[model samples]
Target: MVAVGEILLNALFQVLFDRLASPDLFSFVRQLGGGVDSELKKWEKKLRMIQAVLRDAEEKQLTDEAVKMWLDDL
Candidate 1:
């Protein structure tokens, strides 16, 4: 169950990053010209939040795996 949750979380993070990296979206945003618009600002906030969650998940995964391995070695 825990592993499945981790897999889903990783997949979600990948999809989010891929969407953020889309060239067409970046080009559209660039065309807007100077100063961040509300929509862009909202997206930036959401992206930051997603990034933070991903970072936390990664840290937790590493810690969990280390503990699991240590226990298995016991």
Candidate 2:
């Protein structure tokens, strides 16, 4: 009974997670070498935080205008 929007969001989340762990991305980041690794780590941390917030917002957006707006802004 999931809505299409929810399905698309889940798919997007999976794609993001996949890209984050991708070996090609890791190899390229390593090649970049001048603090790129650190930058990637920082982004990984931020993405995790965002993912958590996204899940919370997904559940809240149904009834909360502010949350819906926040999710939409994403």
Candidate lDDT scores, in order, read 0.64, 0.80
**Candidate of highest TM-score:** 2
As for candidate 1, its clashing pairs are: none
Please report the TM-score between candidate 2 and the true structure.
0.65
- Tell me the tens digit of each residue's lDDT in model 2 across 1-74: 33567668778877887898899999999998999889888888888787788787788888898977766666
Shift of residue 33 alpha carbon in model 1, Å: 3.3
- TM-scores of all candidate predictions against the true structure: 0.47, 0.65
Off by over 4 Å in 2: 61-74
